[model samples]
Target chain A: MAEHSVTAAALTARHQTAGSAASVRRLPGFGWSVGLIVPIMVLLLWQLAAGGAWIEADLLPSPATIAQTFWAMVQDGSLANDILVTVYRLALGFVLGTAAGTVAGLLTGALPLARRLLDPTLQALRSVPSLAWVPLFILWFGIYDTSKVILIAVGVFFPVYLNLMAAIAGVDRKLIEVGRVHDYGKLRLMLRIQLPAAMPLYLTGIRGGLGLGWMFIASAEMMGANNGLGFILTNGEEIGRPDQIIVAILAFAVLGKSTDWLLARTAERLTDWQDKLHPETGA
Target chain B: MTRRLDISDLTKAFGAAPPVLGPLSLTLDGEGITAIIGRSGSGKSTFLRCLSGLETPTRGTAMLGGKPIRPAEVGFVFQEPRLMPWLSVRRNIAFGLSHLPKPERARAVEAAMALVGLSAAADYLPKQLSGGMAQRVALARALAPRPDLLLLDEPLSALDPLTRERMQDHILHVAQHIRVTILLITHDMDEALALANRVIVLRGPPGRIVLDVTIPEHDPAYAFPRDRTSAAFQAMRRRLIDALEPAPVALAR
Candidate 1:
């Protein structure tokens, strides 16, 4: 053992990354610019058709009419309140679902016994449509924010849970061997290697869960809700306001895209060092 | 520094499968490079795994300097770099040096990087590095802790021929400068002759050391090189190839 304390200058070879191009190629601002073309074209065609009376404004309001209704709602501050209510509920549910799912995921992924006992039950529950719980939840927790939030949370939880479980369980064996070789304790191994390894997939799960949260809105806001984008959608149906309906739908679309964009950007920041062929755009 | 590794009848079997490795024994004397050359299924990797405590041996005791071999005292370099994608080269090298203070750990990382000629790329992530550079980072990471023994499990098997040759020279250089003991497992006969002084040929149904020869001339880092380079290389190659030849029958099952 005395002789093993030798100098560590075991090598003297210079190497650089200069030879390999970044496998992930990015052309600044170009992807979004091109992506906007098709949607813009669709909007233009819709407006032309509506103006020429090629379609009835009763069923499919002109883009112009939709924009006017949108502007009026904005001025009245009602749109703002609806938007805020929807976003607040979605965010609250997303956080709650993410926290619970992450804990459950870590348990099942790390422990065989936990996985055997819990996974089958969770998977079966996931198969039950979140909206299917509407009647039961209203009876148990009532139509207050409690029922609505849990309904949204239930929608969000499954994807997040599954992704986290798969991420932790599927970390590369070769990579795990590196941790073992270091004689790392289990906690250190999980924190230093396993957590970081699980991040990319976990982020994907959160993004999917957020999308599911929006899907849950139609069901969650169907009960005793006075104000929200969902309320506007239902209210439009009762009053025969196609323009209002279109406004609500367009708002949901915009909100979903923007939120997903924010999440994708965060994912990019967290996984920049990943050695993978990145998606061509910030999708 | 170097460590003398003593093995007495080490055997490993996964579940009920036939034993992949030994019920064999040998001693690796301290302070030198030993190369274990074998065929793919001959269990060269299993032997190293047992010593590094990655796999538990079904039978045997392996000791380092009259004590049980500790996992912390083993520096392992696998066939692939197996680096953490999230870590920069410097942080990866600093990984095993966690017991040290931050400043000391940083210094140790710098030293290991300097040793591996990777100082310039310390800030680079694994993805930014070329294959050879990644392997060097792996080597630096292992050496940063200044372990009692270095285990190379086909460490150069993934590199191109030119890069592999350069790494051979790097190993020779390391053996010359450091007092550390190295156990290099490879199927490459030329590689075995290029750096190691002690060459052990492993053969199987149950892999065990079949030939253990101390070719003192092969450590060209210490001796005259040109004359011995070809003649001695050829001689050792023949000797290893002969040991690897198919035999008719075993003494008993």
Candidate 2:
């Protein structure tokens, strides 16, 4: 009987743990072998190709040359300054765009009249690609930080707004009924129930917006900017320095990945309940 | 304070379809468990929803303590637990008590959780709970506010048989302890017999009460899990089943 009871307890424990395992598992670590193997192989192959002069050195600088150029830029403090400028633009634009998009999304999602009035025009504006707005933004706001910020904001806005609105609208009606049964006032209902229910999708929207924010920052900075990584890339092309161009591209890739990783970590914390429900996905 | 409920001609219709519920009238002393039994699509849930103010009746009135029924006056437990996935069991119980002072709300939540035997699981999220445990949390949520009337819409229909029986006892214990008027909706006659002091049957496209019977409090045979083989228990069960059955066809005249 004792053995039977222990088995039952173990089974029950397993059942309980099944739903929480994904949430409790540590985020994938930087496993040196798994993470570095492919990149190392690529580097080795590139070294071989560069040493053999298989590809022209000017057109495609060897990894060693790019690394040396990066080191020179870092020593001169140019890389750090460029990164700071790019990061500042990205941060400012992302914040402004996300805030406006979230507010607009909530309004259109919650109020039928707001949706009817604003949604169509916003939908139409969304179709115009982020780069398409570059000229117009520069024309209107000039080539200062304002045009760059506005361009990034415009790029970030549509994804956040569209995804957030859809998420809010898609909140389960049954859960809303639970709030109604409890006599929640309109604002309380939205805050206590609808907002939490919409969080998982809302976070997805923000992440998508952040990705677009980075993409637009490149376009924004490329068109006309004295500082920032994009400016460095353009300058590298003009100066015929493939090493500098590669460095800029690598900078963008690294920045995009790290920011996305941060957002995913924040989302995991915010939507822990969702993670528990779908342990396999850990979304 | 305990309050009486008088529902009269409370009809509900969706769009152009025929009415789902009443033109039905019933009255209750508002202090004991009353189980309402019906077939699927019998509008049992609709009646409860109307009384809980989740749905507005197309016609008629439901009065509680001589006043029209309001949301605050009734607590409804849906068939599904409907606990907020993001909230812990304790917090879900305290959800409806948001208007209370923090200490008072916590006290109420603690008491409700104790009532449902869920104190150990207080901090567990809804997803962490089993189906039966989640349903108990739903009960705790409904009970926390201490509404004048509690509306249960087949609250245990989703549980496994053993869990269902356990929950039936829990419901009985809660009803006796809380002394709140309960209007429970269920299709299970045994569940109705085991938990309800009063049992009602609703039937039809325009749902109406077909039978109403009060179980004797003085009779041991009428107690929960009452000897199913006992003459008194069997007789009552037969009568309920008969009322639920369609009338026998007569010879063409």
Specify the highest-lDDT model's number. 2
lDDT of 1 by residue, A213-266 (tens): 998976788665888888988899999999998898889999998999989888
DockQ for all models, in order? 0.39, 0.47
Docking class of 1: acceptable
- List residue ranges in candidate 1 displaced over 4 A: A1-30, A280-283, B217-229, B246-253
* Residue A37 lDDT in candidate 2: 76
Worst 10 residues of 1 chain B by lDDT: B220-229
Each model's lDDT comes to: 0.84, 0.87
Question: A218-248 in candidate 2: lDDT tens per residue?
Answer: 9998999999999998999899999999999
State candidate 1's DockQ. Answer: 0.39
Q: How many pairs in model 1 have backbone atoms within 3 A of each other, for residues 3 or more apart or on separate chains, i.e. clashes? A: 8
Per-candidate TM-score against the hidden true structure: 0.92, 0.94
Candidate 1 per-residue lDDT, tens place, B1-253, comes to: 4668899999999999999999879898877679999998999999999999899999999999989999888999999999999999999998888889998998889888877778877787887676877898899999998888999999999999988976776677677777788999999987887677789999985898889998776366425232335775787788899998755468443
In order, the B-chain TM-scores come to 0.93, 0.96
